[model samples]
Target: MIVTHEIPAIQTVDFTANTTYGDFRDDLVRDGYAVIKGAVSKEKAAHYVDRYHDYLEGFGLGYDRNDPSTVKEELLPVINEKGMLFHYSAIHEDFVWGMRAEPGVLKVFETIYDTEDLLVSFDAINVSFPNRKDITPNVPWPHQDQDPERPGFRCVQGLLNLLPNGDDDGGLLVLPGAHNISVEFHEQFKDEEQLYRWTNETYFFTDAGMKWLDTKGFKWVKVNADPGDLIIFLVEG
Candidate 1:
């Protein structure tokens, strides 16, 4: 059975209004993630959402935002389960890259790393329609995109919120300060080769990882953000 989670207080930083690099850095160091408020304008975010919708339309999934008659019910499971329409290659596409190179976004990263030179990651975007009775939404399991054995601040991950996230809409959940003890977690699981099949394997917290999260006071902090808000976080195991 799927377990329910209690909502925890999440930290937010206003990138467009008043937050500085120091504030961003400190919060990131403390909570392992920072929600940058208004990292992009609502208008810009809407445009990207439109592009994503167009991609879906072209996917030939028979998905019609307006009409249920056009939706291919047979394809719902495939898309919901495998996310076949969610393509990382969209990073090369205009709309996705536009957000990646967004001046405000790049500025934040530049400030955090103390460097102007940086490489943009080609990441995939998820398009989950709200209040959809047809498709079962993808429930995110707690996991880190970094390897546990390798501690300390390494590469950062970016998620540009093209749509408003919270409640039934779905959002990101973070385990605050989990980074500090990630190395120890790795040491304990080092012998489990299949678990760490890759150097930067995304460590999904099942029973063992959940125990650590619980004991360490690492609650599932929901990250809520508006369209155009970018969530940037340090890579932690």
Candidate 2:
């Protein structure tokens, strides 16, 4: 498949003590994604990065965060029985859950829902390493994290960047304003043999689905964020 990606410039908002709820929600609703800058402290981000390496060592992978020499790219992606995710280790699990329950993060979601009641997703961390000569490029498969039964922005997906990402970095890609028509898009593909479905790991879009989204003017926007930043996107049906 000849896959091409468009990397459009994205705007990020710095979260301050005075940042308003509207600032976050407007970006999310209009762009289908929002980048919250400095959501975590630099010191904390450094700690998490170090902790990740320790977790990998504990899992027998023996990866050194600061030393690339320790990694065998092909033998990578060590996982536990609980599912091979970054947060699979007990240590990472606690760190990830703690991030989810952060007061600032919760406040943003609560304000969007206009209710104090909110549910946090048990999400796993995603780690994509550079491709080796023997490995194929891990291309982006644009898709919505939703099923036809559920419509509108029923759920939100988030990513907390532990490292800085550049334009060429393999990261989350999105289609701005696509969520606004998610219901209609799903209706168009209700009979598809394999409609995009949400999973704990990832979601996917079929060729037909991609073509349809393209026809509707949906284009991919690669996400770029610095350490301590957070990116959230709406998962509409």
Candidate 3:
């Protein structure tokens, strides 16, 4: 049987006033991040997470690549049922599209980007595993999300926390103001392999070797939040 979820329609988040707008902007500018407390509503987030649990139970979970890939649209994860990958977007488009209209998200983006004409897109389920330690650090080997030769503008990344998160539980760890640094910095780090230094310069030069080089020159902050809490991080353009 194709399982179903009980999640209600996610309402449009409203930021109809300057005060509300400024509050979000300030938070983003000052912290390079903003949190929408209770953005998803615990009951709502759980409906989806429960589906993930059921799907994982029947089929299972596996990491697709840099991040885990579920069927992006429905929030269904690719489980590891005996060593196979799957993807499901069982999540509602409203939950995905409505994030753009989310008042908390809009305000923060407006404040940081200084543009009222902002649009946010739900990227993926971004299931942060249980406990804070179950998460991975956001450090990139160098432009992890984009190609090395072609520097692309970073669209803001919004994460829906489907579970409780803490510093110990694997919440996001962001590098403050690192977004403001030149892309050249990332490229430079990309070429240099720290492993080579430790191995007496015996690091073989290969695309795979550099893949493990993960470091960002900036202060990294861990944003702790609950299931309903959402995070918005403004990147280059």
Candidate 4:
């Protein structure tokens, strides 16, 4: 039931504007995901991108930002097939922390929770490259990060795009409004065997589940964002 289709148009918002904060909130509630335009200035994003390259090249493993051949797994950090660099303390890097502390990034969560006091998750940075001949194709693992036992908007996930994410650029693909029916779906599949048993935080959808979503008229959408834009979505969605 892996539905392959053309990417949808970009959905943009202005979370930086006080006037559109409510509109952004409403969109997240209804659509399960929203992209905040220019969450960080283009210049800042480019700087962060440079920092990422520096971090990679700092390994001295022969990785070169200018050479694609140097992107060999043996010459780089332990990046997963999905191009997520979770090892080498990448999450605690200064550039990552700087992005987390960005005013625009913090304001969105503050407005959502109605509080300035908040904690952030040290998530992995994705550097997915297309048409790589060195490794297997990156497969899309469609799953909800929310545990069904304790569901209903437990957390919101944000992806700060440091690169140009066009319709063709591989990024996040979300099932719109599927969060509204998550509870029902989980209840129906409670007795089914879990694919990822090591962690209760992630629940991968089965083919039957995809069929169910299709029956409900839900379609997967590829979220597009420019450099410095932040795409936020519900963990339960």
In order, the Cα lDDT scores of the candidates are 0.68, 0.65, 0.49, 0.83
Give the RMSD in angstroms, all C-alphas superposed, for model 3: 13.0
Give the candidates in order of lDDT, highest first: 4, 1, 2, 3
Clashes of 1: 0
Model 1 regions more than 4 Å off: 1-21, 68-88, 131-137, 192-200
Off by over 4 Å in 3: 1-21, 57-86, 89-123, 128-154, 183-217
| Candidate 1 lDDT trough over 10 residues, lowest sum | 8-17
TM accuracy, model 4: 0.89
lDDT of 3 by residue, 10-39 (tens): 123222223444554456545556787887
Q: Which candidate model has the greater TM-score, 2 or 3?
A: 2
Q: What TM-score does candidate 3 get on C-alpha atoms?
A: 0.50
Question: How do these models rank on TM-score, best leading?
Answer: 4, 1, 2, 3
Q: Number of the top candidate by lDDT?
A: 4
RMSD of 4: 8.5
Please give the TM-score that candidate 1 achieves against the real structure: 0.78
TM-score leader: 4
lDDT of 2: 0.65
Predicted structure 1: lDDT? 0.68
State the lDDT of candidate 1 residue by residue for 3-31, as single tens digits.
95544322333222245456667677666
TM-score of every candidate relative to the true structure: 0.78, 0.76, 0.50, 0.89
